[model samples]
Structure formats: structure tokens, C-alpha cells
Target: MRILLASPRGFCAGVNMAIDCLDECVKRFGPNIYVYHEIVHNRYVVDRFTRIGVKFVDHPDDVPVGSILLYSAHGVSPEIRKAARERKLQTIDATCPLVTKVHLEAIKYARDGYNIILIGHEGHDEVIGTMGEAPESITLVETPEDVDQLPFGPDAKLAYLTQTTLSVEEAATVIRRLEERYPGIEHPAKEDICYATTNRQDAIKALIGQVDLLLVLGSQNSSNSRRLQEIGVTTGKAAYLIDGKAELRPEWFEGVNSVLVTAGASAPEVVVEEVLEHLRQTYGATVEDAITREEHVTFPLPKELRVLQAAGA
Candidate 1:
């Protein structure tokens, strides 16, 4: 068997920044730092942090007063920030700047009296946070068909934004339906989808049909990872999203002569390497790294951390 490893598959800039922020926070503030949610969607990443004493809380009230709290990269509602402030918790926001841009768009559209329709999977952390920007003004749509049921006036000054980690083709299909239904409705001045998501999906599209099977290394709850699996199925190729090499079932390798491998932004490259190593051991497979696009993006750590580091220096 042969393996085609997708390039640019793991640890996108935003994920790196978020994880680094947590590490710096721990170093600066001690192991008692509380994160509002998983800093990133990967289980391995969260488990590693958990072992290091990072507490993941779903409710702000559960966090003690005076404790330092970090927001996840998925972002959070303004309400969450308000609650943290009310509780007098020292706060550090690690929301991906790309996700923050969508929140800003929602706020701007609401201020302009536009009814915002956010395209995203309902209940996703990023979707929930973006929707919370203007809950009264925003409606969530998951599919092209949902666009038909959108409740707003034809002249209601409508606008649409999207989740950063959505499938590029799926979001485009929904947008197309919206455009057809609401001819003059407004859209993001720039696409809200993140660069990493777009590039990863593009890489998958490039190798979909050529491979007998595809393995996406990502957490089950990861939106981008799920989209990668969907993209493979859409191209008529068998694909599975696994958290790590341990989840790799021998049955999946059956009849798969050419397997393509990739990872979501939140997934670690170490997991990919482990998977390949396992495949080599079990199936005696040869691997090749297929370079797709070059990504050089990097995000600076949160401002407070930077200040602390400078002060220490």
C-alpha cells in the first residue's frame, strides 16, 4: 500500500497562537489558569493541557472569583466576557483573530439595522459566539434549504456571515442559495472563512478521487475535521476522521491500496506521523508528502502575555 500525506495539514497559525497563549499563561500565572472552553477543538491538545492543570469550564460561574480565565480560540459571546468581568476574573482572550473579525462584522451589521444570517453548524462554539454578538439580530442557517426559511423582510437590510471552519464548498453552496433567494442581500465584505480551512479543503479536493481511502486526523467535535470527511465523501472517496492513531481500525485499511492522510487545523502533526508509522508497521505502506500550498501565517500571543514577557525581560 501507498500513502499520500497532505501538506499544510496541521497546526494552523491560529491554533498555535491559542495553545501558546495557554502555555504562556501557565508559565506566567501558574497552573491554576482556567480556560472558558477547550483552547482548541482537539481532544489530545485539551487532554495534554488538562494534565498540566488547565481547567476547562463551561460556565463562568463555576470559575472562582479572582482566578485568571482564558477564552478559547473558538471565541465566546459578549455575555461570557460580561460574566467574567462581573466575577472579577482576570481575563485573557485567545479567540482566533479570524473568528473575532466575524464577531465585529455581526456587530457592525446589527448597528446598521441589518438582520444577520450566520451560516454555521448550530451549537458550534464559534457559531454560538458569533451569534451572541447580536442574538436579537442574528439567525443561524446550516444548509442551503435553511436559507429559504430565513425570516426577514425583503428590504430588511439583510447580511450574512459564516463560521471560520466551515467547508468551503458547502458554505459557497449555501451562499449561492442565499444570493438566488435574496438578490440584494449583503454578504461579508470579505469572506469570513479562515485561510487554513480553505487551503486544507483545497488540498483534499486535489487528491480526493486519486486515493482509495482518506484519513483525517482530527477530533470528532472539530468542525473543520468533520468538513474534511464530508469533502472526501462528496468526492466519492471513503474517508474517516480519527482523533489519533489509536482510533485507526484495521478494517478501514481493507481494500484501500492508496490512502491519503490529512489533519485539521487543531490536530497535531505528531498524530499524523504516528498514524503513518502505524500504517508502515501494519500494512508495510510507503509514504509520500504531497505539497499543496505554502502557509506562513502567524498570530501574536495575547497582549497581556506579551506585556508580562516584556516586563520579565
Candidate 2:
């Protein structure tokens, strides 16, 4: 069997900076440091941190006063930030800058008296954060059908933003619907979808024709990861999203002459290697790295983590 390994599969710059921020905190502050949520949506990454003494919490009040509390890469609402400040937790933000841009856009639009239409899956971590920015003004829509149900009048002041980690094609479909429905609606200065999300999906689209099966290395709850699998299935190819190498099944290789392997932004390269090793041992798969494109994005560590690093804390 041939294994077509994706080039730009795992750990985008935002994920890298978020993980690095937590790593610095762990090294400088020792164990029991609290994170507001899973630093990223990958189970393996979260489990690794949990084993090393990082405590994940759902609320700011759950963290002990004067202890370190880091926000997740999906970002958080101003309310959550206020709560942390009120609780006196030493807070460090690890929010992806792209996600932050969406939040800021929401704030700016709402402040300018525009009703915001946010394109994203309801209940997603990133969606929840961006919505919280302007809950009174923002409306969440997951599909073109949702757009049809919107109650906004044609004359209502309108603008649209989107979750950073969304399927690029799906988001475009919704955007097209919004454009048809409300031609005067304002758009963000740039697309709101994360670059990693777009690139990974584009890679899969570019390579799906050559492989019989596509294996996405990521957790079930990862939005971007699920989108990747959805793209494969929609393209009429066999696809599976798994958290780790152990989830791979022998039956999946049945009748599969070639496989395409890729990972989500939060997935670790080590997991990719483990999956490759398993395939080589079981199926004697020949691997080839398929370069889709080059990505040169980087984000700086949180100021709090940097200060700690400088202080030798």
C-alpha cells in the first residue's frame, strides 16, 4: 500500500504558540497551573498536559486565587477575562491572533450599530467566545438554511464574521447566501477563517483523487478536524478521524490500495510518526510526502508568559 503523507498537516503557528506558552508556564511555574479549557481540541495534547500537572477548568472562579490561569487557543469573551480579573487569577491569554481579530471585528461592528451575523457552529468554543463579544448584536448561523430563517430586515444595518476554524467551502456557501439575502451586508476586512483550516482542507481536496482512503489524525471534538473528514466523505472517499494510532483498524485497510494521511492544526507530529510506523509494520506501506504548499505564519507568545520567562519564574 502507498501512504500519501500531507505536508502541511499538523500544528499551525497558532497552535504552536499556544502550546509553547503552556510549556513555558509548566517549566517556570511547575504543576497545577490552570487552563480555562483544553488548550486545543486534540485529546492527546490535552492528556499529555494533564499528565504533567496542568489542570483544565471550565470557569475562572474554579481556579485558585493568585494561581496561573491560561486561556485556550479558541479565545475567550471579555466577560471571562473580567471574571478572571475579579477572581485575581494571574491570567495569561493564549488566544490565536486570528481568533482575536474576529472578536475585535465583532466588537467594532456592534459598537458601530451594525447587527452582526456570525457564521459558525453553535456551541463551538470559538463561536461561543466570538458571540459573547456582542451577544445582543451577534446572530450565529451554521448554514445557508439558517440564513433563510434569519429575521433581519433588508434595511437593518448588517455585517458578517466567521469562526476562524471553519470549512472554507462551507463558509463560502453561507456567505453567498447572506450576500443574496442582504446585498448591503458588510464583510470583514479579510476572511475570518483560519489559514491553517483553509490550507489543510485545500490539501485534502488536492490529494483526495489519488487515494482510496483518507485518515485524519485528530480528536472527535476538533471542529477543523471534523471539517477535514467531512471534505473527504463528501468527495466520495473513505475517511476516518481518530485521536491516535490505536484507533486505526485492520478492516480499514481492506481493499485500500492507497491512503492519504493528514492531521489537524492541534495534532502533534509525533502522533503522525506513530501512525506511519503502525502502517509500515502492518501493511508495509510506502510513504510519500505530498507538498501542497508552503506556510510561513508565526505568532508570538503571550506577554505574561514572556514576562515569566524573562523573570526566570
Candidate 3:
């Protein structure tokens, strides 16, 4: 059986930076560090960190004062940053530069008196953090239907930003609807959806016609991973989101001669290898990694970590 692979899949710059920050922190601090959230949104990454004594907390109070606190890669609201400061925690912001760009846009528009409409799933960490930038000025819209329900006037000096991990097609429809309703609505100077999400989706879209089955390696709650699965199923191919090789169902391959493989942003490469190895052993499948896009994105380590590492601490 032939295997089609999606390029630009798994471990974006933000996820990589966050995970690397944790690894360095653990090595430097000796495994007693506190993280404000799941450093990134994957269960495997979090579970592995937890095994090594990285504590994940949901509130500032959960972490002791003067302790080193690393914010998740999804970024945190300004209010959360204020609270962390109030508690005197040493803050290490591991927010992805892409997510930070949207937060800055929200802040800028809010300051300029624009009624901001943010396109994203409301409860997602990135959405929550971006909305927190200007909660009073921002409204969350998940679909075109949500866009239609917006109560703003056409001349209200509107602006829109999106969560970095949204499905490109879905976000486009929402953007189009906003344009139709508020002819003067402004878009960010640069697209808010990160290059990784766009490239990964494009890669998967390129492979849809060749594969009978698509396996997405990611946690169930991972937004980008879910989007990949939807993209496959939406194209009339069978697709499933699985955490790793163990979750692969033999039933999915029953009539499938060719399969496409891809992974979510936070999913580890080892999971991909394990899945590919399973496919090879079970179905005698030959493997090939497709190159759809070449990515060179890299985020620098948090300032605190940099200083500590430089000091030989």
C-alpha cells in the first residue's frame, strides 16, 4: 500500500519553543517548575512533562509567590499577566509569536475604538487570551451564522482578528461574511492564522485525492488536528484523529489501499513514526514523506530561560 504524507505537519514554532523551554527549565531548575497551562495543547506533551515534575496550574494562586511561572504557548490575557505580576511570580512567556501578533492587533484596535470581531472557538485558550486583551471591545464568532448575528453598524470602525489555528476555509467564509455585512471592516495587515496552519492544511488538501484513508495524529481537543480530520472527511475520504499508533483501528484499513498521514502542531514526531511503523507491520505498507511546503520558522527561547542558560544556572 502506498502512503501519502503531509508536509509542515506537527510541531510548529510555538509548540517547539514551549516544549524546549520546559525541557530547559526542568534541567536548570531540577524539575520543580510551574507552568500556567498545558505548555501546549497536546496530551502526550503534557503527560510527558508531568512525569518529570513540571506542574501545570490554571490560576496564578495555584503557583506560589516568587516561583518561576511559565505561561503556555497559547498566550495569556493581559489580566492574567497582571495577576502573575501581583503575585510576584517570575514570568516566562512562552506564547507563540504568531498568537502574540493577534493579541497586539486586538489591543491596537481596541485602543483605536474599533469594535473587534474575533473569529475563533470561544473557549479555546488562544481565543480566550486574545479576547482578554480587550474583553470589552471584542466579540467572538465561530461561524457565518455568528457573523450574521453581529449587532454592529457598518460604519462602526470594525476590525477582525482570528485564532491562529482555525480552518482556513471556515475562516475565509467568516471573513467574507463580515465583509458583506460591514463593507468597511478592516483586516489585520498580516494574516492572523499562522503559516504552519495554512501550510499544513494546504499539504493535506493536496493529498486528499490520492489516499483512501487519512490518519491524523493529535489529541482530540487539538484544534488544528481536528481541522485536518474534517478536511479529509469533508473530501469524501475516511479520516480519524488518533492520539498515537495504539489508537489506530484495524477497521479503518479494511478496504483502504492507500493512507495519508499527518500530525497536529503539538504532536511529537515519535508518534508519527510509531504510527507509520504500525502501518508497515500490519499492512506491509511502503512509506514516503511528501513535501508540500518547506518551513523554517523558529521562535527564540523565553528571556528568563536565556539568561539562566547563559549564567550557567
**Model 1 per-residue lDDT tens digits across residues 1-313:** 9999998798899999999999888887789989998899999999999998889999789899989999999999999999999999999999999999999999999999999889999989999999888999999999988998877656668899999999888899999998888888898778999999999999999987778998999999999999999998887888899999989888888888999999999999889989999999999999998988999999999897788788893
Q: What's the TM-score of every candidate structure? A: 0.98, 0.98, 0.98
For model 1 the local lDDT of residue 242 reads 94
Residues 130-163 of candidate 3 have per-residue lDDT tens digits of: 9999999999999999999998877788999999
Please give, for residues 61-143, the per-residue lDDT of candidate 2 as tens digits: 89888898999999998899999999999888999999999999999999999999999998999999999999999999999
Off by over 4 Å in 1: none
lDDT of 2 at 10: 92
Task: Indicate the residue-level lDDT of 54 in model 1.
Answer: 88
- Model 2 scores what on Cα lDDT? 0.93
RMSD of every candidate to native, in Å, equals 1.1, 0.9, 1.0
Once fitted onto the true fold, the runs of candidate 2 whose alpha carbons sit more than 4 angstroms away are 311-313
lDDT of each: 0.91, 0.93, 0.90
Model 3, stretches more than 4 Å misplaced?
none
Superposed by TM-score, candidate 2 places the C-alpha of residue 199 at a distance from the truth, in angstroms, of 0.5
